[model samples]
Target: MNQWLIVPVAIPAMIAAVLVLAMRTSMTTQRAISVAATAAQLAAAIGLFVLASDGESRAYFLGHWPAPFGIVLVLDRLSATMLLLTSVVASGVVLAAIREWDTRGRHFHALFQFQLLGINGAFLTGDVFNLFVFFEVLLIASYGLMLHGGGPRRLKAGFHYVAINLIGSTVFLFAVGTIYAVTGTLNMADLAVKVPQVAAGNEALLSAGALLLFTVFAIKSAMVPLHWWLAPTYGSTSPAAAALFALMTKVGAYSIIRVYTLIFGADAGALAGIAQPWILTLAVVTLIMGTIGVLAARSLPDLICYSLIASMGTLLIAVGLASAEGLAAALYYAVQSTVTSSALFLLAGLIARGGEGRAPPLPHGTLVIGLYFLLAIASVGMPPLAGFLGKLLILDAARTSAHIAVAWSAILITSLLLILGFARFGIQTFWNRPRSDGAAVQPLPFALTAVIAGMVAALAALSVFAGPMMDNMTAMAEQLIATQGYIRAVLPPAATAGLVGG
Candidate 1:
């Protein structure tokens, strides 16, 4: 087991406890501690990413117990990629919050750290049961962050967010219980071994359990019918929290990819590739509807929320392909979208500071306009930006699919719709500004501008490094699909070889 595999989860857990119990009173100390911890997380994630590049899947078992009997944390190309992404985004959000958003509520820093714990935990956990535990941990912390500033509107939205997630939690438990009953194990690698050997008599029960888990991830991913919760929930939260919440939905998407590719993949006997049929159809609808939402949005925040939904639509379409090509595209797109969307949210916070209604002229308005221009074209997947490359890769990967025409048509049409929607918002926000009545134009603080600009710069860096990044993602997808390697990393060969009749 690699020792550093535990750093992502353990460091955040320790720091969060300290913030609550040790630095409870001093906001300055809290800020310092949170930033230090986030920096450490980023450093650790970078090291792990480099280590994982060698194509090895590693596991760290809790209490030194072997798999199928104790909790285990697995790290591989997929998890390592996500860990690095989460750390980068979290580091930016913490800095963004420090300027103003942190002072809005008590324990904001604490909740922030806890959510990191959950997000990182979800990525690192190798057992289905512990994944659910991390899901709840993140959700619980998000509840506090969602309602941080405290208003009637925020409170109302937070209630709906909490209620639906509670339902998701209930369904998740039911799924876990059903799976455990059938396979007699919750460790994912164990399931990878046992799921293929499940008796025909029990296939239906196992399929039901698997679909139920998909439902939970779908809701978390904000897929179609379940996507309604996002606009209201995100629209009401503060920008800093909303920026961080960007990964919350991605976790659901991640779980779907991880579980389906491992347990119910092509080798799973009668239950092979079950999610294959539904992924494309729902993804097309999600793309169309989400872009339409972007077109119809009345506020900057609403537009961003809907745009995120639309981006997820684009992402899942790639994932649904289930080929090395498609999965690789999905991985690349996921990284760009996360960074782009978080940056957009932070920019929205800057715009929102101008107060309600049409945007008013402010100091450094020219620079803000320039940032919006770059992000808008990127968001709409225009030329030379990372988003454009991501979509192009997805389109190229779809060529071998049975649904090629449909996939191509939906993506092409929605790209136009997204362009129109973002164009309208850009004109409205930067061009059709309200008349100023000699209002003092206070310049944006240096720290806030630096953080948002840094995020935008990361997107540019992604574009520049697309060749190497796509190559890496292709390998990661291959790594993800090879269940034998992943299983061996968790369970000994003797244990796996003896599981012929498990």
Candidate 2:
């Protein structure tokens, strides 16, 4: 009723556009607007979460047209949860960047706001074309954000980032074009209804389209084979930029769940015989590859980046299993990983500051060492943490679905690789003595530490209340897998209310 969905996406865009003009006159005002805009978006997201928990899903049809003919914005449980997570993490990173903000830059605040606008837009939009538009919007802003300070390394990374994404965009466009060709619509809700009606033989075309689309998403999500770009690009970027990039990949993973479950779920014959099975296979490979990357990487940022790859793999496994519980596990872990991985990267930045312009070498001081151990334990899914709960749910889901071999193997292999990876890094950095000429250990910023601490606390809270959280996530996952709930939420009252309830 409140139309709060629009605020999270549109308010930032409006503020960013105005800031572009105001930036030339008042840098302080621009900074204030940027911070305030993010904070407001965070509040709006929380409101949406409350609405979602009450079983309210809102849909806005652009230009006053109804679904199937016009673009729409739909917010259900999944979207609401993702929006809240994105807002919280984005706010933390933006706040952390306060010390690093460049008041003199022409587009600093403008780009940051626009980047957030794109992210929120992606999370809220109900149309496929709009997703592409938001992705580009985010990427264009990211290009600037990555090179904001204009160093050689940043420039190099930006070039690869832009080039790879340009290719991804092309693939994305091709996939969308094919989907529209077959379904005659780009609205995801509409496509969800129309895609199953496609001819059997033409199913090949749909599969091809889905595969192409998945490829683009896998690249963005940093799935193993397509993940080469992430470490170098993210590793070279500034800490604030890297923190933002950390969450951006989840957008891709989220799309994977959204599209596969909503539009492709009805085509179980096709998906089960080909797409889902292949995805499951890839998930295993991705998990192994990512873990190896972590074990071998010497740099802390690179290790964190590879750890992100591992998390992405874990999510893929859940999605590939295609059960309600599996999806809930994926969603739960997705949130946990986003929070923990970002915190780890921020901590790495803090540690690096204490080094010779690199991540603090292994064997850090006692205080730093303890924190690293805690983070490593969390990242690798040690018991009594949110990560462990998510992993346990995933294993249970896999086992219940009768994929016992894959389930047990995934659990065992992932646990071993994660533990070993972290152990190697922990020993190298914290347990070993500091290098003789390494930079003096600068006091980590309280803001950064506070964020990490908050993430840890959230992880612990989620674990403590795992039962309720799992129940909610299970409900959300059931609705998502059914697709009817989302479609009903997006359609006009006459079309959906009687069928799905208002």
Report lDDT per candidate: 0.90, 0.80
lDDT of 1 by residue, 251-340 (tens): 988998999899988778888888877777788888888999999998889998999999989999998998989999999999988888
Model 2 residue 427 distance off true place after TM-score fit, in angstroms? 2.2
What would the TM-scores of all predictions be? 0.98, 0.92
In terms of lDDT, which candidate is strongest?
1
> Residue pairs in steric clash, candidate 1?
none
* Candidate 2, 63-154: lDDT as tens digits: 77878788788888899999999888888887777665353245777888888888888988999999999999999998888787777887
Looking at candidate 1, what is the lDDT of residue 28?
A: 96
Q: Where does candidate 2 stray beyond 4 Å?
A: 24-27, 101-106, 267-274, 356-364, 433-441, 493-502
RMSD, candidate 1, Å: 1.7
Model 2 score (lDDT): 0.80
